[model samples]
Target: MSATSTVRRFRTLAVPLAVLTVVFLVISLPPYLGLDPAKARLPVPEDVPWFYPALVAHIGFGSIALLTAALQVWPWLRRTHPAVHRWSGRIYLGLGVIPGGVAVLAVAPFGQTGGPTGQVANTMLALLWLATAVAGYRAARARRFGEHREWMVRNVALTFSIVANRPWSMLCIAVFAPEVMGTGPVDPAVLAQAAGVSMWLSWVVNLLVAEYWLHRTRTRRGVRGGPTAKHRQPVPATS
Candidate 1:
């Protein structure tokens, strides 16, 4: 392809994701920036003293992870700007995912509505998030680029899982307690149940979708002997 066409293709794919990432951060970060527990977007449990700070930290770092991971997955950046990709990968893994995952562990057990189901689902999500990221990092270190990409796909799926949680929660709430859709006050128990179910639905669905996409890509590339062009163009860690 011509240089101009390559750049055009890059812009086409990267711009929309970049804008969405910015919008997501803009909507997510403002409430937590004030550092007041009372202003948290999620319901803060009165009994868990550390929940607010931990939740805030997770959101803060998760935003960085989201932005950097989005960039890391861009084909144009990986192909032409390998150095930027590696640096961003480091930031995405170390400064963002690690801390964010740790904070998630700290707060997941304290679900938004004090529900056991959410606690379990969120805990599992955090664990898998960290595991996939670490596995991706290890694969990159070993120069197993295909494995790295696969693991990172799973990692990114978990990273973006929060995006799905809101809608799922709303849908669950609407189904479980339609009264919530109206002006009436929400029932705490029903809210908790819906939140818990949504938490499970969000990460589980994202993960399944990621796996399905990976499987389809692999199947399509079976004749070509690899998953993607990325396997053929391994970005060096230093570059």
Candidate 2:
């Protein structure tokens, strides 16, 4: 319908999503911050001495990415506080995505339960995460605001994938390998299979949903720009 209605609908979704994103980050990041490999949710492979360190780096920087992504995509922040948007975007790309992506690549090969499928999934996610962040940054630098928004949206989707992964992993385990979820000792092979399934499901579903949302926004607005600029504020020079 109208631009105002469209924006209102987006605001309704964006606000809760941002809140939940912060909630997820709070629940996930603190344990890793202690730098204890034993505290990691995934089973850290002892043979790979660097895996735990890399996993810590990934989680640490990824937490920053996820946190800043909430601010970066919030309509009110971009419209009313463009400087915050730009600075957060910079932090998301520079301090978060780049380092986080590298750390994920380092740990992908040593995934505890996902096996080769998990490794491939993680590697692909890291590559796509870095690529989208870079593309978004370049688009902003080129003053291609519309393209930049779309790219950043993709980056945000990737950032949120890990938050979605927990539920997906649990679901996969419950359905495909219920024994893995038992109180008794788990079969490593079954756990690995379930984890591999979850790894594929989580990011793929997130990306698909993101693409669908982008397409719907474009269709409704009939613009290559994913969202309307009617409420956009002038970005600060320092941004």
Candidate 3:
């Protein structure tokens, strides 16, 4: 076997792991968000006019996108069922994410969760998410398959941020809480700091990963095509 064989094995592991990741997020994340009007957690006040509705819309469609995107990136589906791939992609970018992102953007100005730092991070995510989705959709329409795939990879990464952002926050509280404040529950301030770091880390890390994967894919395609390499079909989905 070649040195790169292990990379291939790891690549093959991507889809199943992604599916599991989304399932975990869809199940685990909502309770923490305090979607119920009566049981909101910290970083949110007891009551606000537009908060819960926005949270519901954001989480609702975002969850749909998260799960649907996993299937959209499934290698088998992409290869054997291009129509399914295409339609699922539409549902993901159109119904699930764009609206969800817009809803979050709507809520961001209200300074819901994450406060100023989080607000900034979220707003940035919303804009980038929308831009990448639009870029992907437009690329598809123009028949620029390569560009479409790249942008879709980016949009999917941002979508995964819903899962990614939470861990940094929990980890921060876990490590820093006991050490900094000792005993009892940690300060909300520490949580705020964690939230700040997580907001940036979540999507940023995903995008960096996406860039790395795209580079590896482009390189492989070039090698497969050899010196006269030109037209290349999209590779198995690892986004």
Candidate 2 vs candidate 3, lDDT winner: 2
Q: Between the candidate structures 1 and 2, which one is better when assessed by lDDT?
A: 1
lDDT of 1 by residue, 1-239 (tens): 79998776667434776677788788878988889887887888899899998998899899889888778778877888899999999999998999999999999987766389889999999999999999999989988888898999899889888888878988898898777878688888887888889999999999999999988888889877755644666555783
lDDT of 3: 0.76
Clashing residue pairs in candidate 2 (N, C-alpha, C atoms within 3 angstroms): none
lDDT per residue for candidate 2 within 1-239, as digits (tens), equals: 89997787566456776788788878887778778878888888878999988988888898888777877777766887899889988898889999999999999977866999899999999999989888888878977787798888888888888988889988988887787656677777887888898888888888888889887776878555544642355678893
Error of 2 at 132 (Å): 0.8
- Report the number of clashing residue pairs per model: 0, 0, 0
Model 3: residue 167 alpha-carbon error in angstroms: 2.1
Q: Which is the better candidate, 2 or 3, if ranked by TM-score?
A: 2
Per-residue lDDT tens digits for candidate 3, residues 67-135, read 788766666667778998998888887788899999988777566455677788889999999999999
Q: lDDT for model 2, on a 0 to 1 scale?
A: 0.83
* Root-mean-square deviation of Cα positions for candidate 3 versus the true structure, in angstroms: 6.3
Pairs that collide in candidate 1 are none
Candidates sorted by lDDT, best first? 1, 2, 3
- Flag the better candidate by TM-score, 1 or 3: 1
Model 1 lowest lDDT segment of ten: 226-235
TM-score for each model: 0.88, 0.84, 0.79
lDDT of 3 at 108: 70
lDDT (CA) per prediction: 0.86, 0.83, 0.76
